[model samples]
Target chain A: MKVMVAGGAGFIGSHLIDALLAQGDDVVCVDNFFIGTRENIAHLHGNPHFKFYEQDLTDLDRMLKIFQAEQVEYVFHLAANSDIQASAQNPMIEYKNTYSTTFILLECMRLCGVKKLFFASTSAVYGEQMGVEVSEDAVALKPISYYGGAKLGSEGIISSFAYMNDMSVLVFRFPNVIGPRLTHGVIFDFVKRLKADPTHLRILGDGTQSKPYIYVMDLVDAIMRFKDVEKGITLYNVGVETQTSVTRIAEIVCEKMGLPEIPFEYTGGRGGWKGDVPVFAYNLDKIHAAGWRASMTSDEAVAKTVEMVL
Target chain B: MKVMVAGGAGFIGSHLIDALLAQGDDVVCVDNFFIGTRENIAHLHGNPHFKFYEQDLTDLDRMLKIFQAEQVEYVFHLAANSDIQASAQNPMIEYKNTYSTTFILLECMRLCGVKKLFFASTSAVYGEQMGVEVSEDAVALKPISYYGGAKLGSEGIISSFAYMNDMSVLVFRFPNVIGPRLTHGVIFDFVKRLKADPTHLRILGDGTQSKPYIYVMDLVDAIMRFKDVEKGITLYNVGVETQTSVTRIAEIVCEKMGLPEIPFEYTGGRGGWKGDVPVFAYNLDKIHAAGWRASMTSDEAVAKTVEMVL
Candidate 1:
């Protein structure tokens, strides 16, 4: 099968490309390197089944050309602006990059005769869940940040398109995915801050904000596990049952880095920043029913990610 | 209070403007005349309390300027592409007109210090309900058309903006709003078609699709009645309790026009066109609790709208 990973050179996308290539599927990695780095996919340069395109998926004409030429049977759309803080500051960027990208990709796919799509969604779409175990079907989908709004917008568009065009869509609402090739989020931020000043750590938000985290490899594996879904819109929450708080994560990072107990300074609030959802917990019953479960807890994922970044 | 009504030259907006003016509010009406017209507000030319600006609100700078210069205390955002069929055909136009316009308006509101807003949402935000009674609070909000997606997107942004910026917002999810100066919908379509060919009337769908309708004046009154809403985001389902079928609507149009039994031909299927919702029924419990109700039923609204159009 010919598959195109829209953000295939980014953190999770690059890892997904590796897994897809290992399974002997012909893969086309498309990325503009906006936040996606070239270094992440550099190791797969000479792989026979792997191809790369330095193009923005939001560019409709180019996307159309690529889809037509490749005859892409499945699209793994993961490209988006992940910076929630930046999006809250200026939402237009997120709208154009994330929402418009999905719009253009769906249009291109419809025209190019692609019938299947794997949409990478975020837990932020269920913003301010108040720490409840939110199920996939029961999501109110009120994204607090512009990033989450854009993703939710993309999901609506995808669902509509799938229903109208006789296409199959697999949507995975992910929690904080942590592992190798980590570029952003709390884990990377803590690791970088601690590297600069080992005696003390500065944490955003009151150390109370907490949520589940899925290992990157486990996330990729969950995607691989779902196949031949006969529904128009098959949605799943790909997250573990347990969560770790900011303070607990700080402790783990300090322990992983072989440092003594350090005084922690917090930027006090329920949320780290404006539009930041303080807490989120997903009901993974849907994904678990499909025979995929989180292998590691949030603590283990954060610790391993810290170690990998170091 | 000094107020700004975007899309003030459109049907519902114009009605809203009259109510505001009659109540002695200094009103500034803004519209691009896309689907709106000068004739809708021509009656207000001599009224000193009413001011009209023929400018698109999607222009961020222009919107900010208008907000600042007018010292606009309240904004009624009603501007949008009302054509769902046209939206599905060319979503880009709808995105710019409906979705992008909302984004710009909210940004301008946040920056210009406008704290209160009345947003016109829709039953389409609930998408295809399959004739289920959908309440405002229980809305899953899956808009089928680009127009619906845009409105749902606006709702998310408005809610987030209200939370982040300490603004007050009232969102009303309206059904097929019908009555005087009606520019579009099934009533207007039937009237126009029968006018062109009085011997026969052609319906778009299988004619079994049904949804509620609210008379324009009743809708305007509902907005006026909900005056002292306290909190961030106050939403309501503003439509009649019962729904009228397409076939029933056609018969009403013919009856109003005093025409003979016209041969009714259905173009066929659940929806009138691509991106058309088959069924919609909004639960008005919240609105009823607020001491407002739809005086006219769906059939009455349709017949009155047909008469008005004729």
Candidate 2:
């Protein structure tokens, strides 16, 4: 089978591409490198089954040409404006990159007769659910940030398109994913900050912000495990059961960086930024019921990510 | 209070404007006249309390200028592509008229600090939830039409904007709304078709497709009752509990037009159109709990709409 990864040069996308190539599936990687880096997919330069396109998914005509040319059977739509805080400052970024990209891709897919899709959604859609495990089916998805809103918008569009066009869509609502080729996150931020000033670390929020962090490979494996789901709009929450705190992450990063005695200073608040979701926990019952579980815990994933970045 | 009613010359918007003007509020009406007509708001030309601007809500700069000039204290965002079937034919119609309008309006509101908003959402956002009364709170919103998807997207964006900018938003998920100045829907379609050929009436679905139809005045009343809600994101299912069938609607239209013995021909399917939702029921528990109710039932609303249109 042939597949196209929409954001297949960035952190998780690159990892997904490698896994697909290893499994002997023809892979087409498309990325404009807005948040994605060329270095991530640098190792796959001369592979036989791997093709790459540095193109923006928001351009409908270009995406249509690619879809027509490749005869792409399936699409892994992981493309989005990944930076939540950056989107909070300039909402047009999320509207154009995140929401419009999904709109254009769905239109292109419909036009080209593609019938299957794998969408990477974020748990940010379940905004500020405070003090309960958010399941896939329950809880009204009221995203606090522009980024979350855009993702939720994309999900609605994808759902409608799937139903209207007789297409099958697999939407995975992911928590914070951590591992190698880490571009952005609290882990990456901490690593960069500590590298600059090992004596003091400035954390964004009050150290109590806690959430689950799934490993990149584990997430990729979960996506691979459910690749052949020929259902109409199958949604799942993919993450480990356990959670790690901000303070715990700080401690792990310090230990991993060999700077155990670094002083920690916090810009005090419940949330790190204006649109930040202070805390959330995913109810992974749906994905777990599917017989797929993350191999690493939140702490374990954070620790390994720290080592990889360091 | 000074309020701006977007799409103020359309069906429900005209009714809302009349209500607002009757209650001694300064009304600034903005519309591009896409589906809206001059006849709807012709009576308001000499009224000093009501001001009309023929402009598109999708233009950000113009909307911002209007916001600054009118000092619009609250916004009743009713602007959208009212024709769902037309949107199914061209998805970009909803993208530009429905979804982008909301995005631009919210941004203008945010910039001008005009916090309060009353967004007109729909039951289409609920999609095909078979055999159960869908409340405003429960059920994952998987809209099956481009129109529904755009409305749901607007809801998500409005929720986030309300949360992020400390604004109060009142989102009403309306069922089929009927009565005077009815631009589109089954009743309007039946009346128009029967006028063209009084001997025969053509219905879209199996004629068994049923859903609640709220009267426009009653819906306007509900919106007025909750206009001052200072809460963060107050959502309500605004509709009558009773449902009217498509065949029943056709019969009503024929009777009103003095052609009661007209032959009924159905296109024969669960849905009238490809993205059409066959059946849905709204749980009015939330709106009832908030001390509001629709005065007219579905059958009465449909019958009355037939009379009005004829």
Candidate 3:
């Protein structure tokens, strides 16, 4: 199979590229390197089957040229400005980076006669849900932040395209994915802060906000399984069933670093900052039924991420 | 008051500009003329208190320059790509025109130290609702189209800005605003089609989809009242309380045009198009308590709009 992974230089994208190559598929990795780094996909440079293109998804003509050259059969769209806090401050950047880019990719796919697309959505799309476990069928989408809004907007566009253009789409709403080579995550932030000072970790929103987490490998596996499923338009919640509080993750980071119990300070607020969702958890039965499950708990994922970052 | 009306040469913006000028407010109308026509504001060109600037809001520097030069006290943000069908087909253009432009304007307003802003939102943000009267406090927003998603995304940004900064915002989610100078609406479309072919009127859907409608003048009145109300971030559903069906609107158009009752043809679908909301009616109690009301019924508004367009 010939596959294109947009943002394939980022953490999960790079890993997905590795797996796709291992399966002997011709992979075309495209990245603008906004948040993605070249180091992430450095290992694949020597492979004969692996080709990388430095291109921005917003430029439709460039993307179209790549599609034409590769004759791409499927697309895995993982590129985005994923910082929720930054999105609150600079929403236009977020909209351009996430929503507009996704639309451009979809349009390019439609023009090139691509049959299938896999979109990397976020659990942030669930916003502040009331239930402990949010199902794909449940009404969990009411994004509080600009980042989440852009994701939801992208989902709407993808669904519209799927219905109108007969494009098969599988949207994976991943919870906080943490793993090795991650450029940004709660565990990575904690590790960086400890490495810098090793004194106190300042937590946002009282450290009580809890959310589900998924390992990067687990997310990639789920994406592959959901893609194989013959569904017209499938949206799934991809995450471990266990929930972890920010305080718990912080403690796990300290434990992994072999440091003394540091004093934790809280920024007293309902939300971490403007446009933050204080609490969220997802129901993973949809993807689990499709023969995929999370092997690591949220704490385990955080610990592993801390080890890799340190 | 000194005011800057973005997209002021467009339908609702032009009406709002007229109202602002009649109240002796200094008005600066900014437009890129994408969907806005110069003829809408050509009459006000000679007024000493009214000025016009042709500029796109997406250019932050240009928007900032205009804000500083105009000494704008209040901002009426009405610029958007208004076609829902077009947004469904071209999501990137919709996101750029609707969401990115809004963020740029907000940033420009913040830099210019503008304290108040009025955002023209749409009931399309509600998507398809089961209730007869949807309220402002609805739990979830599942917009089917890129245009609605962009509107909802802008609303999120405005709410975040209000929460973080000390900016006051009033978001008016209008329902099918129709009146004189309107470029696109059911009434306008019907009038144009009947003029071209007097015997047949083609409706998009099954002619059963109902929507709440408000005359543009009444909408302007609601907006002015909202501006006077001091609030941090207030959202209101501004529309006539009654619901009007497409079939009834066709009848009204025929009666107003003094033509024979045209054969209404149903295209057989759930909505006007793939991303259109099949039915929606808003609850205007919040706006009514704020001392504003639409004097005309939806049927009356449709009849008046047909007369004006004809």
Task: Write down the DockQ of candidate 3.
Answer: 0.25
True contacts kept of each: 0.28, 0.64, 0.16
Best by DockQ: 2
Tens-digit lDDT string for candidate 2 (A169-274): 8999998888888778888888889888888999988989888999999999999999777768889999998899999999999998889998999998888888
**For model 1, what is the alpha-carbon lDDT of residue A181?**
88
Per-residue lDDT tens digits for candidate 1, residues A1-310, read 8899999999989998888888889998899998899999999989889999999877888888888888879999889988777777777777678877788888888787789899999887776866477887664666677777778777877767776678888889898888998788888788889999898999988999887878999999988888456758888889888888998888888888887678999989887888877777778887788678888988888888888888
Highest TM-score model number: 2
Q: How many steric clashes between backbone atoms does each model show?
A: 0, 0, 1
For candidate 2, the per-residue lDDT at B36 reads 92
Docking quality (DockQ) of candidate 2:
0.74
Worst 10-residue lDDT window for candidate 2 chain A reads A87-96
Question: What residue runs in model 3 are displaced by over 4 Å at the alpha carbon?
Answer: A85-92, A126-144, A196-210, A228-233, A245-247, A261-279, A283-292, B85-92, B129-140, B197-206, B228-233, B261-274, B283-292
Q: Rank candidates, TM-score, best first.
A: 2, 1, 3
Per-candidate Cα lDDT values, in order, are 0.83, 0.89, 0.81
Q: In angstroms, how far off is B1's CA in candidate 3?
A: 2.7
RMSD, model 1, all Cα superposed?
2.1
Estimate the lDDT of model 2.
0.89
Using all chains and alpha carbons, the TM-scores for the candidates as numbered come to 0.95, 0.96, 0.88
